[model samples]
Target chain A: MEPFRRLAALACPLVEANIDTDQLIPARFMKESRASGYGRFLLHDLRFDAEGAPIAGFILNDPAAADARILVAGRNFGAGSSREAAVYALVDYGVRCVIAPSFGDIFASNAVNNGLLPAVLEEAAFEALTDWMGGAPAELVVDLEARRIAYGGRDAAFSIPDAWRAKLLNGWDDIALTRQHAAAIETFARERLRAFPWVAPRTDGPRGGAQPRSPDAGETRAGGASPQSSDL
Target chain B: MPATLFDKIWDAHEILRDEEGRSLLWIDRHFVHEGSFHAFDTLAERGLSVARPDLTFGIADHYVPTAGRPRIADPKIAGMVERLAGNAARHGVQLFGLDDPRQGIVHVVGPEQGLTLPGLVMVCGDSHTATHGAFGAVAFGIGASEVAHVLATQTLWQTKPKRMRLVVDGRLAAGVTAKDLALHWIAALGADAGRGYAIEYAGPAVEALSMEARLTLCNLSIEGGARCGMVAPDATTLAALRDRPMGPAGADFDAAAADWAALTTDPDAVFDREVTIDARRIAPTVTWGVSPEEALPIDARVPDPAALVSEEAARQMRGALDYMGLAPGQKLTDVAIDRVFIGSCTNARIEDLRAAAAVLKGRRSRVPGIVSPGSTLVKRQAEAEGLDAVFTEAGLEWRDSGCSMCVGMNGDRVPAGERCASTTNRNFRGRQGPGARTHLMSPAMVAAAAVAGRLTDLRDL
Candidate 1:
């Protein structure tokens, strides 16, 4: 993950509200593993026609917006599904920042994890940025550390949680974030184990008392794992 | 201090609160599927074994075909499922692979196996993990990176979400279902109404829902931008889990039930926000546009862009109308569909099957229809009750259990330029397939649509 400090790049204005994850990158394109390149499929359905030709009218295919590194969208962008592939598609397609009035909770979390900045601006500020981009190719500056976005004599401040801001500045994945609270986590586990023993993992064996034993201790089959007849 | 069920679960799982108020929260149960293979790879890269493999469970649902249990022909999907099974084996984690009778959608299998108990904090690699919160748990989806974090440390760093309460009072009209309630709420509140909040569903209407119906409601919480949705445990909840194979028995069941009984919000507790809805006003809702919030009652006409107050709203309305190929003043019931899908974690339970089956008992569908149960158990139960026969007799393809057409990852899809009346959450563009138009509705309404070859109201049917 690269630390996000600042970027000044051409912005593509997509004024449609509720640009969900499915629209960003549909589920069918999520077949390949996370490491595979997803840029080709970013907004695949919307950007291409049935003949596999690029839809020239689409914003991403527009000659003027071809080099956009920032996307200015409407409210509630990324509002659906928890697919991190949405962020992967944007980042792989050279979109480093998305300026919106609001975002889906899970999508925003996934964005931060992938080093993509979801800069939330007020509705008026977001509209201003889009209006400016609609006129001509414009460069938008996003300063994460300063929590501000500026373009064409207009500037606005955004808000992000302190912890997430630190993670974005430090380029820290969740593993590194969790490592900072290792001692506290261990303490909590010990206390919880004693306080709620029933919630612990089922290490005593398979769930039911009458289930047949597995041929190998480590590999268990579903033969005897059906719900009881009475229960059904 | 009085705490809601969410607070009880969160406080019980909190390990530490940092200077920035982010807590290290412990995960009691972690559910994984084929989509989670990347997380396992991350753990291997770090040379870290699963910290608590016993608490983690894996299933092969996402890419597994719902028509048959044949070997997956797509190498990429096959490899992902194989990797999931291999990773689970190496870590001593239990896996329900393609051939397992227990293999099903992870959300359906978890609660069916009694693993998603009340007052536990659960996390899965899928956003619909909030389905488990219907059992009074604090559950939500985590990203792949967070998935890896939990696999390695059995904990996740988090910021507590503000709590909101939704009280739906009164009685639902006949033929209206939990799916309608969820769609109506999303339409009324807009997609981002629950953003940055954890929500609790309460009031007489929610309490009257069966456990499966409650699960259906919570399953769609993600569609509304909520972190999670929960319903407190009551007699109905206890009875639903009474003698499940994985649940407690004898004296243990008694003790557990007592604890669950106390897992309710205190009467005097206050929430960060609250909203009240009249259940009687809800109709059989259907989404007309890309967003779940763009829904209207089945009898309503397509919204006119001219009537919209804001330019942004009108722009979105025009875009949706263009993509969906719809016109203002058009009745939803008059909109023709190419197919019908009755499945997904949202409404593929045995009860949902019965509802659709009853509608299709002696009726033949004018258009093609597919029925995929939520789990193998659900499939077997439907078959035992001859619900599968009814569906097959009515020309609806009765298939095996998995997330069939809901996510379109299993090769089941609606063709381009075709419309479908579906029972799954999310009517987002290309959600079912590329250029596929989806109208979100309940299972019964989907059955009615299959018969009418258009979006038809169940009440009219």
Candidate 2:
């Protein structure tokens, strides 16, 4: 699928600083397969009362804030836990961009890799925007193409490393990237084996012999070679 | 023209530089946990073996079951464990498997076993690898690709990081422990103020802390966007290092101590950024929202979203308020909790357990909770001191050594929509699991919350 690039602005007010990954999707949700809808579970515990009813006083419950999309968070959004599920939850929740005074280092990278726009803005501006959005559908425009955020009578420019941006903008994962470079990688491996013969294991068969079999394909590859290495 | 501790270590480890000017640095040790399985495959695909298996260690954490001895029943998980064992054996790296007596969280085991030491560079796939900085080492977490590189070459290509000095000058107040100080710093510094920095914690407050306390302080360095948090080794460090498994003995002990003592920063060393905190004002803290920095003094009120930085931020605050089910100006203590977790590398030590046990000694908890010992040794020692009985008697489940509910990788998890007061790091929206609300705090504070079945101030309790 082509990457989803439409941007929406969040209408909720600012939360306290240091929103961590644990609170984003929680560890329990990890037990469920990724294919299961993680969206419904997002903020499942935090949004509802003990009786499972939505807390009427919460900002998300206010009708005026409906369709809120952009998230202008307090300082240090995305702390704790290394789960990429937080990114999944945010994206699934329809949050297009997160403008924070700062973000957890690892969490920011995860968000970037997962295609979430984690923008860092000055703290004062973030506070100003929070004051302006009070309980209304404040329009915040996010231009992924230009890496700029516009809203609340102001515009903010940001930067994302081109390498990471390209991955997100194209919806290509690490595996996909490797696949894209497959030919070059194969050539590099062949060349490297020739140059540093000691590093690569020797093969006994003919030069173009049928592709060597891969043993223990389904076996665990934890910290060791596969059990089928004898086949070589 | 200027020399700093960070520069000294960075220079000492530098072997060569790539054409891009990135320094190729030597790695003294590489630690792994269950979560970084992908890195192992990456190394294998490259047709390489661990460069120095003797210096590498593997532990099964992050997903090990906390309440049972049964090799995790989930086939996929079991496969992971088995694969790890096979991988370690094949590579000649020592594996501290789930049932191993020496097994524990990698960070905890490293210090306890004396594997982490002064002037060394430690790397792990887990962000909390900064926990090793208590030993006066340069420690940091690396990406899976970096982990693979370390396994194959025992070296890493690194960019120089900035250095920051967070000096706490005064004595800490009564009831204020290292956990509180870390939370307070994180709260004030906003969790990312030290991004790409190596933080050297100094001054009277840091000097007075024990090695365990220092570990706790350093453990949260990643929370502040720092690669590590380090303290110069002192007499206290020597005392702690002496009894560890790989620690110096006889004449070697004296020699090691001298080297450790010399690792301190020179008096006139400069830092890129400096922030000072008055230790006296620190109080027991607890999280009110999803992040560690979202914390407040135990008695503080929930923050008002209307007071946030931007309308979009305010909007997120609204969503956070909705998710946390909190009202503006509501006292944090009034928030009822369904569970409590007091474990993980953050707060599962004997001291942490003792503090919580003292609080729960004669108290009854209104909520269900778990107190997991960080290691088998810790579990044994706590039971010897009847700490486990104190928790069990207080209605908290005393689990075996494992990561437990801290991240809920194991089966031990709260059901959907349960609010828990946890002593572990991160109170992210659902860190413990889906529909699980976490409020992070100190072990004693978590105990207080458990007893009251709500977010209660430790001092009041």
Model 1 has fnat of 0.46
Q: Model 2, B434: alpha-carbon shift in Å? A: 0.8
Model 1 chain B scores worst on lDDT over the 10 consecutive residues at B242-251
Best by lDDT: 1
Write candidate 1's Cα lDDT for B1-461 as tens digits: 98887888898788877787888889999998988877888898989889888789998888888765667777877777888889999999889889887778898888877787898899998999999989999999988888888999999888999999999999789999999999999999988999999999999999999888899999989888897999999987887766555666556677778778889999888899999999999999999998888899999999999998987678778988988999999998899999999999999987888888878889999998799999887776666567777898889899988888999777899887899999999788888888789999999999999989999988987
Question: Per-residue CA lDDT of candidate 2, range B1-461, in tens?
Answer: 45666677677677665444556676777887766666677677767677668668898877788765755777766666677788888898888788786677888777766677777788887778888898788998765556776777667666677789999989987778888999899889876777868999999999998778888899888877786789887877776665444544456556666655658777788899999999999988888775667788987899898888766557766866776788989998899999888898888876788888888988999999888887766676566556777899999898887777877667777666788888787666555766577887888888988888898877886
CA-lDDT, candidates in order: 0.85, 0.72
TM accuracy, model 2: 0.75
Residues A4-70 of candidate 2: C-alpha lDDT, one tens digit per residue? 3557555455455666666566554554544556776565555666676887866666677666666
What's the CA RMSD of model 2 in angstroms?
Answer: 11.2
Show where candidate 2 strays beyond 4 Å.
Answer: A1-79, A82-103, A107-232, B307-310
Chain A TM-scores, candidates in order: 0.85, 0.71
